[model samples]
Target: MIKRYTELADAVEHLLLEKNSEFICYLQPVTSREAALQWLAQYRQQYSDANHVCWAYIIGNTRQPQTQAFSDDGEPSGTAGKPMLHVLTERELGNCLAVVVRYFGGVKLGAGGLVRAYSNAVSQAAGNAELRMISPSVQLSISVSFAFEARLRQLLQQYQAALDDVAYRDNVSMQVSVPQDAEPALREQLINETAGAAVIRQVASHSGV
Candidate 1:
């Protein structure tokens, strides 16, 4: 299952040297092939003078990936793209892209050196990135007698849940979102506390986000 992911909110830099040449790795989060390619194009435009704008990207879940692509630009065939892709996969990051821009510094690092430099760039970016996880959730709606409003509010607080679309006419009707696993217990508490007077309906199933 795809549970957690690490992504960058903005581009991050990893700088290194190999025989005086400069390799800068820029890591950005992207959700689709189009976005990944757009990142590559934007980098190319921003670094128009760069010697090679090699890139690698995975477009979905790391474990069950949906799409992937890479390009070496003008660098050695397997040096830049393959190495960058390797770093991202090993880090178990999904829905992100990696672009490595090389500036010619009057130095020529051979195939092995290029691989090391490119991989190191991506590794450095990964090391400096911020990681976030998906939280499980459920959506529900509740209707209850006006007299039970304050009481229901207190019960929801127990689960750190809150009513979102509360309305008052004859009684109270509102929407709430809570932790997925807490739904059963929350329901039980409402029914028991109200002596079966509370009406609860689930609007959405458990989801990870």
Candidate 2:
């Protein structure tokens, strides 16, 4: 999965100095397509007079329902947008938007230069930002009798589980976020800890931000 930040990333205002051309790349975190579009609009106004405002965004996880968009902004069709999108896809980055604004210098860069420039801009920006993994988490409600409450709390602490709610009835209901992969292990542990007394059930699963 593509993370928001990279441990070691490089940043530069312009990649090519000889051509007198300048490129500004901005890497922003965006959750939805609307947010991505809004960021594009904001940059459009910020660099209204620039020659090109090319951009791309990846929203969602690696599995499914991932949304992506790109625009060449008057550059050769597919030259700018597709290249930018390629960088995002190849890097496996999601929930992020990258905008590359170029102020055309006197000289013209061929199609190859254009593609390389846009792709490099994004890659460099990604390098400069920190990247982290956001895994899928599930909340499970576990019930235990008051007799086992103290031991249950100790087990929860050992597992680094969070208590969502509690009831003073004969049993206590506690909710905890468990990693998807660790759910089975957690369930087994809980069962063994409670000696089949406490029952653990999944309440919900979601991708955390």
Candidate 3:
């Protein structure tokens, strides 16, 4: 499991020129394949005159991404998009996309030159973008009687869990988000402190940016 990883804080771009060819690289934070594609469409529209719009993305966990895809557009196979993706994975960047727009400058760079151009386009530009750590998390719903409400709250605080929601009725129902790595210890503490009276149900898991 990816306990922590880096992701772009915001969109960034860099331009490189190699052998009279222009390569403009754009790096942005994206959560899913759909989001990456949507951005790709927008960039294509924005740079409609570009000769090529190559792109790559790694969504979700960096160590083991939930989704990853790339396109070389019209460039030679494995020359453009793959090299850009290599730079992203080498940096262990998750939930991000790198798109390169090229303008033909009437110069033909060989495959090796193309790869270096695309790779450097991203590697150099990424230094200008802000990045932050992401911690994967799990959300759980806990139900307990009023008698154990205070103890449950204390346990949640002890584990640095985020109290998402709470409701009072015949019993106290609370929704909380906890770091994935600490879920087991928190669960055990809840069971012990509430004397097994707390009912915990996993709601969903996500990355805590």
Candidate 4:
């Protein structure tokens, strides 16, 4: 479970020159693979004349990502994208996408040079950008008897949980969002307070409040 992690606060772009070759690095926060690809497409189209567009993305926690990928584009097999991604992981950036567009400057940099160039490009961009922490939350559906409604409400407030929805039926059903770190304690309290009658089912997990 991700209690908290750092992420880019906003989009940033940086330019570097190596042996006259231009490397334009773009950094943006992205929550999903689709969004990463969409942002990459925009950069590709924007820099259509560039020689190569290399990209990498980490869609969840950097320490333990849900998914991540990289593309070298037309660059050497292990030159561009992997090095850029290494820089991002080193900096512990989560939910971020990096795209580097290279414009051939009439000079050929060897594989080693390409790797350093790409890595340095992303590193410099990240150094210049702002980062903020995110405490992810889980969405849950809880069912409890009417007898425990008041107690549950108090617990929710105690844990600073968000009340999303409430439905009164055979039992009182509630939709809630709670901080990942607080969920275990909340669950224990719910069960103990309701004398093991309360039930909780996780619906989804997401970053932010």
Which candidate comes out best when scored by lDDT?
A: 4
RMSD of each: 4.1, 3.8, 2.0, 2.5
lDDT of 2 by residue, 1-209 (tens): 22222111222233433267777888777778998899889989999999989998878752342688889999888778888888777776667788899999888888888888888888877666666566666789888887888887877676656677777776787887866666777788778877788788889986653
Q: What range of 10 consecutive residues in model 4 has the weakest lDDT sum?
A: 1-10
List per-prediction Cα lDDT, in the order shown.
0.81, 0.74, 0.90, 0.92
- lDDT for predicted candidate 2 compared with the true structure: 0.74
The regions of model 3 sitting more than 4 angstroms off are 169-171
| Candidate 1, position 90, lDDT | 90
lDDT by residue (1-209, candidate 3, tens digit) is 55878888899979999888899999989998999999999999999999999999999766788889999999999998888888888887788999999999998888998999999999998878888888888999999999888888888888889999999999999999999999999999888877788899999998877
What lDDT tens digits, residue by residue, belong to model 4 across residues 62-153? 88888999999999999999998898899987889999999999999999999999999999999998888888888899999998888889
lDDT per residue (tens digit) for residues 116-178 in model 1:
999998998888887555444678889999888888888888987756789887889979987
Q: What TM-score does candidate 4 reach?
A: 0.84
Candidate number that wins on lDDT, 1 or 3: 3
Global lDDT for candidate 4?
Answer: 0.92
> Higher-TM-score candidate among 2 and 3?
3
The clash numbers for all candidates, in the given order, read 0, 9, 0, 0
